[model samples]
Target: MNSAANSRMIEIVHVNRTFQRADGQMVKAVDNVSVVIKEGEFVCLVGPSGCGKTTLLQMVAGLLEPSDGGIAVAGREISGPGRERGMVFQKDSVFPWMRVIDNVEYGLKCRGVPAAQRREIARTYLERVGLGHVEKAWPRELSGGMLKRVAIATVFANGSRVLLLDEPFGALDYVTRHQLQSVLLDLWDEGGAAARRTVLFVTHDVDEALSLADRILVFHSGHLVDDLAVTAERPRSTDSLLLPDMVAIKHKLLAHLGLEKRAKPLAIVQDGAAS
Candidate 1:
């Protein structure tokens, strides 16, 4: 395939997801969505609760099959989980019993990578995420931010070309969240070949989505209500130029939830003046 074709890392074609409740009613979580995620692109899914942002991520991760349509990564259909994609969920899914290095090596070990090579890879990624000093620390010994760093290092060590982040920083406090975001961006930039990893981040925080995403996809009532490209330069800072767009998108999303008055001007005004 040409470079242009190779650039498309993921494709969602006419996808729909519906679940039958025990009460015999159908709940559609995603509706007729089609999108293409290019290689190295950072895409975020954001919307109100119950819009199926997480469900959509799960579908792309091949954890759940769409009720209709298809999802493909690197031009191949995704029927099941594979090493091509690594996922970090809302919770720190690390094994509490395992030390930090052990958790980072787990995936490589499962894949039959030699112990020496796995350790080397784990060390490299741990250092990349600023966790090199805590190689022997157990999950319980680490702070929430530290644990999240370990989880990120673990996933990156697997050498996956696509990353599925389901609100990895959702539970962290403001300072911790900002710190992790910076670390994530640095790692994403420094990964070199791995740097081309296409990322699909799901978050309810509009600021987080706006700050990190190359593009943002808004979900409303199981349908893709908006696909907005973020034309800002890389290493994005949280600034007024971006906030208005984010707030505008948030308001548009709110309207889909039957809320009135999209975009709170007072909030925007205060934020802008403070900046």
Candidate 2:
């Protein structure tokens, strides 16, 4: 393992977040959660709907505050959003009024990166995401998948150390989802081991988590339930899930979601042929 992988990047110490309901009830969205993620690590937060996975991710992104405890990234406590973090939501984050290249350049522009340099950076990432040809196109002109690619390129161009993705591909079709996942993985791995950014991806799909995560953190009813390490080698595929270790992890995750995989019935055959 590299030195970056050994250094702690994110620390959540006994964090808790709660919200008051209109009915005069207080609900704990995240309860006493604590975890440490190393620099360059890809960690997935997974749980069923309303299980507080997203809530915990938002706290790390500085979009929401924990009612108690603290979250520190790179040793500094996070009070609000910062340039060190970039978040991509499930919804389309591309600006309809801006051209694709401009959308990708927006973050750089905000940080006062020189126009020429930022434009070059934006173009580079656009090409990386396979959107170089559509740089001049408006968000409204692009398909849903294309728009998502634009959003992704934008965050990478901004050069954040930590990437917070909240089900960014959840709304896409299966094929598109798989394609986007590959795109994300390619970009993430492009920087090589030493330059890799820390990623905290929140997803409800167990397969998605298994495919991308170096570590999987399971949440249930606003509490951290399971923390499992995935030692499986990268460039994993659908068949990876069939491995004994991966299968066992999947079973545990499904059980947390109140689900169980059923055994497939064997097909009848006669004389080694279908009946």
Using all chains and alpha carbons, the TM-scores for the candidates as numbered come to: 0.88, 0.92
What is residue 249's positional error in candidate 2, in angstroms? 0.8
Q: Cα RMSD to native, each candidate? A: 6.9, 9.7
Model 2 poorest 10 in a row by lDDT: 266-275
- What is candidate 1's lDDT per residue for 1-275, written digit by digit as tens? 45765677888887889999999999999877778888898898987889888988999889999999888888888998888899998997989999999999999999999999999999999998888998998899998889899989988999888899998999999999999988888878775644567899999887787788888887877777767787676777756435666677656645544566644321110111111
Q: How many clashing residue pairs appear in each of the predictions shown?
A: 0, 0
Candidate of highest TM-score = 2
Question: How many angstroms is residue 171 displaced in model 2 relative to the true structure, after the best TM-score fit?
Answer: 0.7
The TM-score of candidate 1 is 0.88
